[model samples]
Target: MAGPLTSLKVLDFSTLLPGPYATMMLADMGAEVLRVEAPDRVDLTKVMPPFDGKISTAFSYLTRSKRTLALNLKQAEAVDKVKELVRDYDIVVEQFRPGVMDRLGIGYETLKAINPRLIYCAITGYGQTGPYRDRAGHDINYLSIAGVSSHCGRADSGPPPLGIQVADVAGGSHHAVMGILAAVIERQQTGAGQFVDISMTDAAFALNAMAGAASLAGGQEQQPESALLNGGSFYDYYQTRDQRWLSIGSLEPQFSARLCDTLGLSELKSLALSQKPEDQQRLKTALKDKVAEKTLVEWQEIFADQDACVEPVLTITEAAEHPQLKARGMVIEVDRGDGVMQRQIGNPIIFGVKT
Candidate 1:
């Protein structure tokens, strides 16, 4: 039995999270992905920390099920090899800044000329055309420019730096996968390949839909932590007695009522949607005082059978072992050769049609 993309062939010249992640998804779906690495510039993740003596855990996890092809694209012979290889591969993914690949003689136009059916994808920070295309940027810069960091943090404090690379993975990686797959479908009908230009910042801008509706469409900027989902309502996280945190997302009237009743704060339920600063503070303070009265474990026990959407905020290790996550098989053990098994995050999508 084979996965959905078993017959697809992908030649990946991308490194790091965004491009690698896109091709990794294809590889996981059973595509034959060949990671094309420059002879002089190996992927930095190959030497990143948390290693198994010599092998990098990060690189191992990302490059799994994919073959590697080292080539010096700077040389004419190497560029010719790539042009030849593109004729056989169905897809090509690259993550260089604008013009880098074009200078290498293996740009989209050159490859498409060789292989008309090749789906070429280019992932960059700003994109290939704009004024900032040549500018250097990472996830933080992309998020900041994309307007995602504007309403990210607390109202009192400035935007707290994100723990994850939202722009890299959510914006670039996910969108690259989407654009490539859409191109794949289109190619089936037209029998022609196309270029997929992915900009991290551009992709991240779409994630501002909720806040964008209020700001862009309504002509009023949403203040940080002043919106329903941004911590304006009574739905937020509170500190427990043991210093652990508990998240409460009882947004609906029924759920709010349940939470209020469970906490013996029935009088405050009516103020759930209050926009008044004082009322919001009073309700938040009351809930905080109540939550701080018990440990996270105690709160978890109290809400175990409740529909209040109240749950303890567990650490990464705790989350990995959590009952719900374990039951759903979100964490899986992958054998990394020589009987060495490492726990990796499982794929979320469950296809109905098994190969």
Candidate 2:
């Protein structure tokens, strides 16, 4: 049985995280993805540590279910070959800086001329137009430019380095997938393809979500730890006796009451709903002290039966082996096409069974 995107074909020229990630999702959904890589281009993922049978572990998962082609676009013959592939591959994803693709003679307009139904998606840090269009940037630079990092960390400490690439994955890669799919849908109505410009900074700015809405419409600018959800209230992480972290999100009155009861600090329930700075500080202090009294496992056991939104922070390895994630089939084994099966993170999308 074919997957949902069985009819789609993708030609990916992007290296590293963003574009590869987008195409990976497409391949996971049954789209045939082919990578057109330069013969000498150095992709860090290919050489990164922890190799599984010569290739790096990350490259194995990112390139799962996708075929590869080495071609140097500097050669006219190679460019012609890509143009030939454009006639068959309707979707093209690239991460080159602005004008680089045009200089290579394989830009969106060039390909669209050959195939009017080509959905060309360009993923960049600052987009196709703007002052920083050609600027070099990474995940943190985009987040900082987009103001996402402004309110993420503690006020005193400033923005701490995040463990994950929020702008690359959440902004660039995710938006490219969405834009390509949307163009595919619109093509059905208009019988034409369109250029999808996905800027990591632009998408990161959009990620402000509730905070952006409030600031744009209500004239309320949120600073670090100034918002209710960003550690302004008692709904934050607490350190346990064993130095492990536990996230507490008992915002609702019911959950707050339950949390306080579970901690034997039911008297602090009134302070939970109060937005007063002093009240919030008081509640936070109480939670910190109580949480420090026991280890993470001890608190997990005590709150196992409670409905309070309290959960211990588990390491990535612990999360992989957890019963809930195991039950959800979040861990899957991908065939490496060499009789060897490689374990990789499974796609999160759940689709209805085909009748």
Candidate 3:
């Protein structure tokens, strides 16, 4: 099928996750993405664990639906070749530390001059400008600096970080895609291309809009595991008898009451009367005890008829085969050569066009 971005051409100069994942999304939508990698640089995804023999599972998963070209940017001839390629591309995405591109002589200033209509996006840890712009940082450091890590984990703990790389993927990758798309739309009208500077730390801070709002209103202090949506019994995960997990999100009183009814806890139905801190604590403790009475499957069956907004947690493997996922085509099998058909998460966007 002809994809929405079939006419778009992208030149990607990024290693690792953020930039590659962003371009992967575009490639899945039919954009022609060419990834530029260093010839001798090791694919970190292959070096990391959870491998399948010599195959880099991480690379295999993230790099699907795109083409790759290894080049040494330091070489003058390679730089000229890249410039020629960029002249014919619609978008250029690079994820290097600030000034790295300038030093390589392929920065936005140089590229935009070559291709006036080229949309250039730069993704970095701190951003193109700031006091910490040149400072090195990772996902954890970005989250910490953005005040996001402060709201994670239990009150007694030292604010444990989230398992996923929120700043890198959400802030960096997804944000870059959004910026590029917006720039593309604007370019269509004005016939002028511009630069997109995306900061992982700044993006992390942007994700905490709700928490920032709460702090601004003085509704509550942003404490670890203390926020309304962060910890409270009404909106958290619980363990069942079989050690399986279930997540509850009945923040509304009506939904909480429905959950209580589903659990046959008439005595504690009053617990859903208010969302006060003490009330939430009591409700959470009561629900934890009640949920522990049965296996996750039992609760799933019990709440099948209620609007309690509860769902059993599924592992990555189970999630891939979930009925809803299958129905929505959330996973797809792709042939990756070597007589292997690998399964990867499919594109989430559903275009009107059929393939």
Question: Which candidate wins on TM-score?
Answer: 2
1-355, model 2: which lDDT tens digit per residue?
Answer: 1579999999999989999999999999889999988898878888998988877888888888899999999999999999999999879999999999999999989999999999999999999998999999999999999989888899899998999889999999999999999999999899899999999999999999999999889999889988899989998999999999999999999999999988899888899989898999999999999999999999989888888999889998889898888877889998766779987898887688523
**Candidate number with greatest lDDT:** 2
lDDT of 3 by residue, 1-355 (tens): 2589999999999888899889989998889999888888876874777665566778887778888898899999889988999889999999889999999999999998999999999999999997999898899999999988888888887667676889999999999999999999999999989999999999999998989788768676588777677884458999999999999987677887787777887777776766577887887888889889999889889877788789999998899888888888998887654568888788898977544
Would you list the C-alpha lDDT of every candidate in the order shown?
Answer: 0.89, 0.92, 0.87
Give the clashing pairs for model 3.
Answer: none
| lDDT at residue 70 of model 3 (Cα atoms) | 86
* Per-prediction TM-score to the true structure, in the order listed: 0.96, 0.97, 0.95
Order candidates by TM-score, high to low. Answer: 2, 1, 3
Q: Which segments of candidate 3 are over 4 A away from where they belong?
A: 217-219, 353-355
TM-score (C-alpha) between model 3 and the true structure:
0.95
CA error at residue 65 for candidate 1, angstroms: 1.5
Where does candidate 3 have its weakest 10-residue lDDT segment?
Answer: 46-55
